[model samples]
Target: MDSGDILASLGVNGAAAAAHALSLPAEAYGNDAQLEVLWAMKAYNHAEVYFNLISSVEPTFLKLTKSDDMIYSKFREDFPDMDIKTLDPELLKSADAKEKWRPFCNQFEGIVEDFNYGTLLRLDCQKDYTEENTIFATRIQFFAIEIARNREGYNDVVHSARAKAKQQQDQC
Candidate 1:
């Protein structure tokens, strides 16, 4: 199926889930570091979904690389002083944006994790169909679902961030 089909399948709830996942604070949305983190998280999620879906159609495909390393590097560049050794759950929980999102962030993350790895892998290993078609369908579907879900949240974040950035720029 194409991206549209995937989105159509996800319906409104799926779209909401994606939006909630990508939503960021107005101040942080435009920060390169923040964008990198969000994109990295998004890419990782997409890769997982793609992998699972492909595996479902073809069980022999098992290749794992540090594809998400770029995103990590970006984060490091943006926040060089940040401690990388540990992830503080409290930090995520205490985040201003998270507070704004309330329980939605947790729910969104859960859904992304669930669909990304397992589903993609399962789809990849399917032995009953053509690999090329399946992969294409999976990619499109995943992309569409993600885009539809996150577009609104992404836009909101970006717009708010841009406005804040402009104010800061004027101050400078």
Candidate 2:
């Protein structure tokens, strides 16, 4: 039977669970191409949901994980002058960026689950997720950048804009 048939037999909820489970690579999986694509799509949707959440609320008060304060502190210490609000995509994907980020990411090796898992991150806090605005990075890196962006008030505009839109909708 085809893979589609197998998935179809599982039903919609089962298929969704399967996709989420396959999104993270395991030792036994051994880098399957299909699994990688599934992971990418799941990561993209995760990012989209995160962006929507932050835009609708005050990002500064949101705690993504239990270690929010610790993550933000380390990020600030490691990247003192880095302007995450205006972060450039090329800079984030550059070899230099990886080299610099490795040490920061490594600090949370045991503390953060799936710290090295691939994830999608937005280049600018002011922009919505789009093909041109997103980049691939490790989960820890995404959290660090986003935590810093939130704490630094870069994401405040999203909340204000969303509130304005809601107010207009309510009036109409």
Candidate 3:
């Protein structure tokens, strides 16, 4: 979930050596207030950066993908019978999209990966992609809904906040 595990996985010997050199005396991590604070801060920072990055990238992807109708139509065309709640999440998550879902995968191309996929909350739970619900989904799913909002003009809710910040900066 974090860089430490990634470093360890990529090269155990190097990671071990680095940790040995940089780390303090061996000590087991305790489930204490300090540990909790560290985790909370890390999670919040990561999420804030990630959400903003996604928000900023929305325009570029919208330009690339074209119309909102095209995005949704492509979605429907790919999975005419999508009932994710009924299906097995593990099975669906690992199913190869390269061959079967080529169109969708092609849209994202090299940028997306299985690891980036995780649970996301949609704020407006009334509709499917209303930014009001959280569900476990792939990177493509995030793109689909976000692109849907971008093209359909629903993202002004997010954009307006940015505009306000810019306005404040300009005034200052």
Q: lDDT per residue, candidate 1, 123-148, as tens digits?
A: 22212123331222222223322232
lDDT of 1 at 42: 51
Task: Give me the displacement of residue 98 in model 2, in angstroms.
Answer: 1.4
TM-score of 3: 0.40
Q: lDDT score, residue 57, model 1?
A: 30
Residue 108, model 2: Cα distance from true site in angstroms: 0.6
Highest TM-score among the candidates is held by which one?
2
How well is each residue in 48-86 modelled by candidate 2, as lDDT tens digits? 789888978799888988898899899888888887987
TM-score of 2: 0.84
Looking at model 2, which ten-residue stretch has the lowest summed lDDT? 1-10
Q: What ranges in model 2 sit over 4 Å off?
A: 1-27
Which is better, 1 or 2, measured by lDDT? 2
- Candidate 2 has an lDDT of 0.83
Model 3 sits at a Cα RMSD from the real structure of 10.6
